[model samples]
Target: MAGLFRRTMDYLYLACVVVGTTALVLISAVIPYAVFTRYVLNSAASWPEPLAILLTIVLTFIGAAAAYRLNLHMNVAYFANKLPPAGRRLLDLLVQLLMAVIALFMIIWGERLVEVTWHNTIADFPFLSVGITYLPIPIGGFCLLLFIIERIFLGLPPDPITHGSEAPSFD
Candidate 1:
């Protein structure tokens, strides 16, 4: 059962990485095109800007979940690291609990936001529903919640080695 759960989470994390990367690439391409069309061609495109904004939202939320799972999210580890091993473990558990709460809030409010905006259409793209743009919020929240649960129960994955000057190797 544990193996099955871990495998499932691994797949989900991979999916998040793929989706986040695709959104990031699309946003990068769209923004430059929007800028070029507006400034270089002297004809501003309406859809690109809004599309890029939506993609950014997707990238941010989805990427955040992946980062959290990988333990790559920004955190202040100074105080926690200074503590003894048991204390550090307790602190880590506490932090995970807090993250779970935040994820729950996102899931609840994000769905509400989607419901409220479901009937509204995007200004730039009349065919696209505004609620569709907000889908990432709840989806990402759910991903984050799953990761939090996995970490709390299964323990964290091993840390990857860093070779850069910013993260020097002690060994």
Candidate 2:
């Protein structure tokens, strides 16, 4: 059962990474197109602005989720390495819990925002709805939330690479 759970989580994490990568590529392509159309052709690409905005939001969250699963958040661990094992574990748990709380809040607030945007439409891209723009927030929030929960179960260190760290390597 534990193996199954880990595999599932890994699969989800991989999916988020693939999606995020695709979004990044799309953003790069669209932004250049938008710029080229506006300057060279004297007209903006109507879809690029909204698409880029939405893609960026998605990429941010997805990247965050990937980072969380891999325990790749930015932090200095050189000092934490001097601490005793218990102290390190305590600090690790605290950091993980704090991140979990933040993800929870994002999920809650993002859902509300999604609901509000669902009914409306975007100004520049009339064919596309606002819900599409808002979708990334909740989706990323939920993915981050899942990774956070899994991290809690995995008992991750605040900084796994801290000085003299002997913890098993992962991710």
Candidate 3:
């Protein structure tokens, strides 16, 4: 069961990385086309900018969840590092609990946001529902929540890239 859970999480992390990277690549492609069409071709393409904006939403949320799993998310530990071992452990758990709260908030509010915009169509891409574009929010939040659970229950999974060989944190 434990192995299965870990394997599932590993796959989820991989998916997040792949999807986020693809979104970023698409955004890169989209923005250049937007620029070229507007400045060089003498006509701005409306779809490119909106498409890039949508892709950016995917990149930000999914990429952040992946980063959090790998402990690559921004973390300031100045005060945490100063605590005694026991105090540090407590603080670490506190941080995790707080992260869980944040994840829940994202899920709840993100869903409401999606529902509220469900019927709205993007101006440039009328066939695409605005709510469909907002899916990454709740999806990313769920991924984050899963990763947090894994960290709390199983300890951090071995970093896929580093295999847990990161430089030791302060004792």
Candidate 4:
């Protein structure tokens, strides 16, 4: 059962990486096109700016969750590293709990925001609901929640890129 769960999480993390990278690529591609159209073509496109903004939101929230799963999110290690082993473990657990609380808050409030804006459409893209753009908040929260649970129950997974090596890499 534990193996199955770990495998599932591995796949989930991969999916998050793929989706986040794709969103980032799309945002990069769209912005250049928007700039080209506005400056070279002398015609400002309405859809590009809003589309980029929406993709940015997706990239931030979703990519953040993916980063969290990989233990890549920024943390102040100076104070924590000063503690004894047990103390460091306690502090780590406390941080995980705090993160869980924040994820819960995001899920609740994000859903409410989505509900409230469901009827509203984007100004430039009338067919797209304003709420749809907010979906990343709740979705990212759920992903974070899963990662927190995995940490609490199964311990942090080994870093895929580093394996178990502690050696410094110049590359």
In candidate 2, list every pair of residues with a backbone clash: none
Ranking by TM-score: 4, 3, 1, 2
lDDT string for model 3 (1-171, tens) is 888998999999999999999999999899999999999999998889888889999999999999999899889999999999999889878888999999999899999999999999987889999899999999999999999998888888885554355766667
Which pairs clash (backbone N, Cα, C closer than 3 Å) in model 4? none
Output the lDDT of residue 136, model 1. Answer: 92
> TM-scores across all candidates?
0.91, 0.84, 0.92, 0.93
Best candidate, TM-score-wise?
A: 4
In the predicted model 1, the residue pairs found to clash are none
**Ranking 1 against 2 by lDDT, winner:** 1
Writing each residue's lDDT as its tens digit, candidate 1 over 6-35 gives 889989999999999999999989999999
Give per-residue CA lDDT, model 4, range 114-168, as digits (tens): 9999999998999999899999998889988988888888999977774436767
Error of 1 at 4 (Å): 0.8
Q: Residue by residue across 122-142, what tens digits does model 2's lDDT show?
A: 788787778777777777778
Clashes of each: 0, 0, 0, 0
Give candidate 1's whole-model lDDT. Answer: 0.91
Residue 40 accuracy (lDDT) in model 4: 98
lDDT of 3 at 48: 92
Superposed Cα deviation of residue 153, candidate 3 (Å): 0.6
The window of 10 residues in a row where model 2 has the poorest summed lDDT is 155-164
